[model samples]
Target: MDDLVRIHDILQHATPESLVILNEIFTSTTLADAIDLGGKILGRITAMGLVCVCVTFVDELASLNQATVSMVSTVDENDPAKRTFKVIRKPADGLAYAMVLARKYRLTHDQLKERIIP
Candidate 1:
């Protein structure tokens, strides 16, 4: 995969002073695969002592190791569709990707059945 190739490059060349930023990666794969592979990449980055900023939808990634510091975007409780746009520095929890994203995008069960296009 393209991501794997890029990751290989990073692992081979990145130094401690480097700042690595990764967006949602391995998205074409399953949740378990995404977490497993992404977590390994994070592990390598931490081992190299690189100052990395990894933004991911995987909640489990929030607590990979001691070097990882997670920040999560919050949604309004009263209006779940409204993003507070406030990021809190904490480990993400109870966000099982599928259900969380469905709710976040306002794709309720009824709404999904009514949709024609993504």
Candidate 2:
């Protein structure tokens, strides 16, 4: 059972969208379970000294519309070891909410998505 799942895991990681990768793997999981998995995955990455940034756009759905997001990174580009911001595609309102949420959480780039503009 484990071996079959492991093989499938490797192939799935080849997906371009991390969300799709996660969603597929976590199909039977609840939202809390998803969050737990994400935290563990991120914690492991962080422990390895890899910076994980969540770049969101206006909305995950809006991203299908070709929206673009503007972003800022804390690290100096000259520093090869630090993470950098590369713009993501999303809705404008979603991008704004992501920024606001990031600020509230005192975090940057943990997740990116659009929001309702109303």
Candidate 3:
């Protein structure tokens, strides 16, 4: 996502979904701790070899209703790798946060760092 043009286009067309995205990303066990210890959950995911990383872009979710967004890398059962999701506090457009925990997975520190890098 380093390409500004692509990033801009994503921002333009991106519409965040409701917080349910978070539910789909992490299991009920992990979801219980997502909001309280978001950092820890993220760390655990990375330790598990997943790529649920945080991003720092202009978030439109906030504009919808003081909502906050968190980026994640969830595992896809149907696929071999993980998928990214934008976790939002409130529901908005048709887009929902990416579910990185849809499947079992983990990510190393280097991989986590790469995803966080701007």
Highest-lDDT candidate: 1
1-118 per-residue lDDT for model 2 (tens digits): 4423753564445343333222223335665664454444434433444333433221332222112222333333464334445543323352234454465555654333323222
TM-score of every candidate: 0.79, 0.27, 0.18
Candidate 1 Cα outliers beyond 4 Å, as residue runs? 96-109, 112-118
What is the per-residue lDDT of model 1 for residues 3-93, given as tens digits with 9 covering 90 to 100?
9999899878887678898998889999999999999999888888899888888887889988889898888787665678898997787
Ranking by lDDT: 1, 2, 3
Of the candidates numbered 2 and 3, which has the greater lDDT value? 2
Error of 3 at 116 (Å): 44
Give each model's whole-structure lDDT.
0.83, 0.38, 0.35
Query: Worst ten-residue run, lDDT, model 1?
Result: 93-102
Candidate 1 structure, TM-score to reference: 0.79
Deviation from native of the Cα of residue 31 in model 1, angstroms:
1.5
Ranking by TM-score: 1, 2, 3
lDDT of 2 at 108: 56
Candidate 3 per-residue lDDT over residues 1-118, each given as its tens digit: 1233433343345343311112222223343343334444333333444322243222332232212334433434475354535343432343333333322343555556766985
